[model samples]
Target: MQTAQRNSLKLLQWMMAASLALPLALFAFASAMSWISTSEAADQEIQRTLDVAHEHALKVFETIDRSLAEVTEVIRGMSDADIVAREKGLHARLRVVAEALPQVKSVWVFDANGRALVNSLVSPAPDVDFSDRDYFRIPAERDIGTYIGEVLTPRPPYLGARFFSVGRRRNNEDGSFGGVIQASVLPEYFENFYAKIGREPGSFLALIRTDGAVLAHFPVIDHAVRFEPSGPLGRQIVANPLAGARTLQSPADGIERRMRYQRLAEYPIYVSAGLETAAIRSRWVSTVAQHLIFGIPATALLFGLLALAYRRTQRLEEEASRRIEAEEALRHGQRLEALGQLTGGVAHDFNNLLTVIRASVDMLRRQDLPEPRRQRYIDAISNTVNRAAKLTNQLLAFARRQTLKPEVFDASQNVRTLSEMIATLIGSRIEIAAQVPDESCLVNADAGQFETAIINMAVNARDAMDGVGRLTITVRPVNDLPSATTGPPNPHGHVAVSVIDTGVGIPPELFGRIFEPFYTTKEVGHGTGLGLSQVFGFAKQSGGEVTVTSDVGKGTTFTLYLPRVVGEHSPQSLLAEDAPSVDRANASVLIVEDNAEVGKFAADTLTQLGCTCVLVENATHALEELAVDPSRFDLVFTDVVMPGMSGIELAEEIRRQGLDLPIVLASGYSQVLSQQGSGGFELLQKPYSAEQLARLLHKAARSRRLRRDQAPAG
Candidate 1:
């Protein structure tokens, strides 16, 4: 009987091992499949984002082009000599027409000599030179039927405005060339026209110039404005402008995103729109996480039932189940950990994307659209951009990319302004008071960041006061005094912004560690513990510091010390140079550009500015052009990056040929220009407007002219 019992025990051990093995294999297979599906879903989400971006971008291009074409037609009508010679009578008629056209920021007539004959903005003045402007020269070249220039920030007659000027060459009644008729339109004219687009909270649309400068961003103030890609996806799209829909992880918040972008065929512009996956597929992620967590255990229970059925006829199966239980628990924990990491990565990318979209929208709002139809479309665009901004703020608050935009401003005024907002923020549970002096105290800090810091302090106070508290904010000028608790004397003049709360004070021991990232005193799900860290970061970034003064039951006061600017600091204006005369006498120009648009623009611009332009695509082409007739070209205008050889290489080749053709290398990126710095050659940035192009060509042409004039006349 004893021998029979030992054999049964061995058999039970084998059964236990088999039971664990069967469920383990099934669970492993299920986990792999789930992860693969999640990854594929993430990729699909990215593609969808790209598709949306492309459609929105295409719309911006079409709207801008169609509007310009319509304006061109209008200009063709005004080009009549009867209208041009009437002068004052024509001005009265134009004003009547301008008032009727809301999109027309300004409608002007230029004489054959490019002198302003009638301007809608002011009484016709000839002070400005239309001859040197792009709106005049670009259409005159007729290289492209229509054009869209880069966004120019607030200038004369258009304060804090961004608009595209549409132009067409005018002709005299005798069929001779008149000059040009032009109109500048703000995108707001089209804003309401495109209001049909339904964009999610975190989605955005942007109208970008060919060279990558943002022509118009939705939400103007909230949208991203930089030409190059800001986050990872933006970088990828820029690297390959022709890319269709694609997915990318943004570094700003580490969220997986979908982007759609398309370049306009006629204009040098692209319109793009994108959506965050979290906003679009939040349900999917939640479902995936839920099933992965609960499905395995439930499925395991089903397998256990099968095991019980097998053991029903065999009582010995229960003796060796400990090892099986241990293996199952370990495997389940492993799968959960993997899922967590995957989900976290996806969330981060989503948050980063929202941050960028919001910033882009903000930038877009800054654009001033004048065309009624275009402005209506842009208004719609602005709405979409604003939604994108709201989405980003949430994501940034989650991912901690939301930093401060500090400017020197009066501290007391800021505190006083926050009075109403703080009251609304704290609700009826907290009473707020501002103890600020009337004298102006300056602090270099972001108004929003300051408000957030105050809100956080108020919340902490409310919590200490057990959901009720009194909050007092004070601002004062800081002189040569050691801070409330500092070891050294103040050097930089400072302003003290203090938030005092009648709440349970923080322990002294926890003071130094409170500002550590992710360190929170609140319970789980209550906070991410980044509030104080953000406050700390804001202070440090503003060239200041945050100090705390608190006693066990004496309440807490968080004081932010910020550097004060002496007197005042105003924005410096770019030094403007008088337009130089185009002296092309005997100047020959060598133009190298791989892209036809840029190369043609440079060459035609040079020729117009009075130089013989020799066009080439690469270094080899330039060398070949020079080999045939070395003296044909006097100055070489080449792009830095080319197909066969670079601009630097081509310059070297010219030096080897013993030719001193003044070389002007143009590039879009500053890095390449910096690399060729001070090499006795001038470098011009690409996507240069007509005036800039004219200026650079003249500089090169005049330099060559001087060299020739100095040399013995051959």
Candidate 2:
């Protein structure tokens, strides 16, 4: 009878548990259903905003271009000299035309020499030169139908506010490039219209040229700011859709938003509108929170009834077991529920990634897919893999304390520019003072690692100050080491970047061990103590040193001294690979890859490309193969990261042995490559395609042949 009672009690407990979970289950189901609907609604709303912005931009641009055409007719038969003779009359007419359109600030007719003959704003046009501007220069190069110029500030006679121009080129008697007729476009016209449109808080509105130049923006943007064609939104715009909407992070401000963009039908301009992602998420969360608020109390009530019933039917012996079992089941249910939510949240991003791969794969499976389409699909897969590799790199880099890639850049500018970011990092309670001279203090080191070091020190300083104190960062060139007494200074001169904080300073007794790896005074879960160690490691590796001076409860200063270099870096452009890539159809390649699978893939891919290949698992074997026959291979292609000897080290060894073979190093990421950059060898970044491999191999082999031919006779 007692056994029966226990079984009955157990059944009752299970029923109550199920009842407790019912409300939560309903909430979860409701949340899941609403998520998709909510996201679609958000996208639709943004699409509507984009349409408004696009219509406004089109109308404004159309008006400006039309007015420009009308003004151009005024000087159709007249040359610059002829226009100059009738300047006052033409100027009055131009002013009349400009006054008719609020979007157009002024109209001007410029000669081939960029001299303003007549302008709407002023007669004689203030003698301001437009020759150097794109509007004047582009038309001078060719008889462009309508040229849209970059944002520019007008000279003396006009307001200094920014304006873009729509200009048409006039042909000379010989049909040669002549002068320009420009209408200065008012950016405020777009901004004011954008303001009138109803949008969610933190929405963004922008008008941009197809070439990735910003013409105007709603919230106002820096005139010089431009987006890269490679960014997410840029890619979408380049896809040449009539209109599209998606979520992406803005390149200018780094705010993620659900954005929609529409292109002007006849023009090379695209207008974009976006609602901030955080706002959308907040709205969804509010809905979910309401469900949670209603569900939780009901769940508690069911559990309370269960607890009361269990207490009433208790046999102390079985009661303990029942409680433990019931608690465990509840905990398991909670964990499962948490897991479901996490999966639901993460699935969105992963599904998007998978969709790209899956669509590409499905296309590949087509029986009659065109070669061009096939190649595009292949490229898409490769790109998606590269994207996944980057995500993986972030995790690995965090755990592995990834190495640096150094560049020659000004340290003072980095400090000054990073001050605002640091302010965001440390909190508003902390006052930041940055001291960087106008003169550049160039250093040969990794800019990223330098930034990481600065961030670490700033974070530590923030904590030391208890989030409210003056933090000063000073960057200046120093020849002598006043603080780094323990180490010698860089004889060439050192750039001393110091982070000083008026806070609860570090105890001097701990200074020696502070730079030690995994040795942190910060409470557990706060830090792993790798920050200072990394800072110290970077300084030493760059042939410099770090020093710290602290007073207990007073303040502390951490200085990083790096070897200074004496030059500015000329900007390097990353242009796309030339068409009809170089090919070495029957060239011999030595493949050095550590992974069996990767090595097999490289060998197989090269073979398919009509290249004779030899696969080696390590640098030692590769060197042995080269030693056996020095000129057997035309190119040595190796992976960057490896056991025993790295690809970089192998390349150096091959050179040391005086082998004439050209080496192409490949990697997704590596310490040496990151620190010292390509090392003057041709580098093929990992996740490359067969075409990329073929092109690089051909270049390397061709280089080898050239070197041999150019060498003095043996």
Candidate 3:
């Protein structure tokens, strides 16, 4: 009887323990189901958000890609054009094309001689040359098409807007390049695309050119960026249709994000989209919370009536373990995506600041002052400018904005101009010898830029020789020169400018990256690692090619291959008699400039020049003045790169009305004007002194009379 009583007590104890365990197990199982379902839902939502963002980015890329496609079609048609007979047809067609495709801002054609044959908007000055542009130079290396230019204000003929260009070389029936066809699209057009794509709040998108310029970006991080493959992201998506997208936890927001990337099928562009983690997991957490609230009470009731609960607890613990592992993986992806965004953002902003400061300083040099004080102040300013310039050079080197500007020029003249500078550039310890043709060999190029490039080469040579060495500069034209087998191809009819240096030669390993930005053999502070980069930019910008042949411990030879200007050299017909000049006192002039300092300088100078100058801050104002009275002004002096309508465009409108009044183009970035051929229109380069300003005005006044005489009778 006593043993039976004890057994009954044990049974009761077991029953009570079972009752407690059943509810606990039921609650555990409910919690496990809720968490698993929530995690799956979160993953699904994350994927969905990523998909949506990706799709949005695709649309933006498609828009730009389609524009490139249109450009390609135009180029293909130009290749079949007859150089002599169809020059007019080609120019007219390009104009029609510009009008047809509102997306395209400007179109240009270059002859085999590197001269502007046809431009859609403005006629080039007869003297302007373009043999030194990369679009014409790089074709020799390979058949790489769809070249994108650095962000810049468009030159005349396509003025009033900043643009990025794409280029293609047209081949003759004999497979020789007939000419080059280039399409310059407004920079804002791409930015506008980014703006639309960036509609997503707190989201950003970037479109980088192959050369590493941030062509388009949402959020406007500094306007441009130069990134390298070896950047923090370790590799850049330079290939078509970026390989993949990654997710990351943002250091900025501390939020995990899902990212997706894709490259355009047509243009060389990579697009990426990021989805906030809160957005991705919002639905999942909501569903889980709802389930948890209902399951907790229901589980408690169910468990209260359950007889076996220990087994349920084991099942619940296993489910939680699996869910935790999956969540961890999802979290890891978010981190990688965030890193890419950070890298791009930093690079873009940093470059913008550098460009802004550099440009500002360059423009500041235009102010007039006493010789001694001016030189002293300029020296100080130049020191700072050089620092910024070096920074920009490195940025460009990395971004690949550094390119050649090839053109046919007089080799002897180039050397003669540099003789004085070269004397100072080369130390007393180094002997400099130059072998140049007496007659100017018409090779394509950017002469000023070339001089600087030569200076850099000389400096490098001096450093290598430890302030003692012999440097030889040779210039001559070569027939059927083989194109460079290096970075890009050399166009036909290339003229060679060779810089031979006797010094410690570069190691073979360093040769490959010697032109790379920030990659230097010199100790820090001694070099910014951009000397070779500048050389590269200069060569590419000119319609030419650059190659370096070096032997370790021997020396190095840098050769610039430039296209030749084919055609008989003819001197301009100078009028022996006195030509009529526009009366500045009676002439009303319109001035448009965005920068206050520049505008003020222009207004004051013109007023002092005896002209009735009306100053306006933007193209809009200038246009308004003309709209009120198209014949109100006899001349217009305008800034080419402005916030509103470009001076070139303003001139175009005036020209459209047959207003043959003189128009003067002004800008620090004169290269654009030279490329565009905004002539018979006069040009004044930025940082001009009072003397330069007066001379240009006097020239413009006289040229207007000559043009009036050339006009056809109605």
lDDT of 3 by residue, 132-176 (tens): 666666653345765666666644443486666667666655777
What is candidate 1's TM-score against the reference?
A: 0.33
- Tens digit per residue, CA lDDT, model 2, 192-291: 8888784467778888887788887767766466878887767876675667776777766778878778888788787888888898888889889987
Instruction: Please give the CA lDDT of all the candidate structures.
Output: 0.63, 0.79, 0.62
After superposition, candidate 1 runs with Cα above 4 Å error = 1-116, 119-142, 166-198, 218-224, 229-243, 248-256, 277-284, 293-297, 303-714
lDDT value, candidate 1, whole model? 0.63
Off by over 4 Å in 2: 1-4, 308-714
Return the TM-score for each candidate structure.
0.33, 0.43, 0.33
Best by lDDT: 2
After TM-score superposition, the amount by which residue 403's alpha carbon in candidate 2 deviates from its true location, in angstroms, is 83
Better of 2 and 3 by TM-score: 2
Question: RMSD, model 3, all Cα superposed?
Answer: 35.7
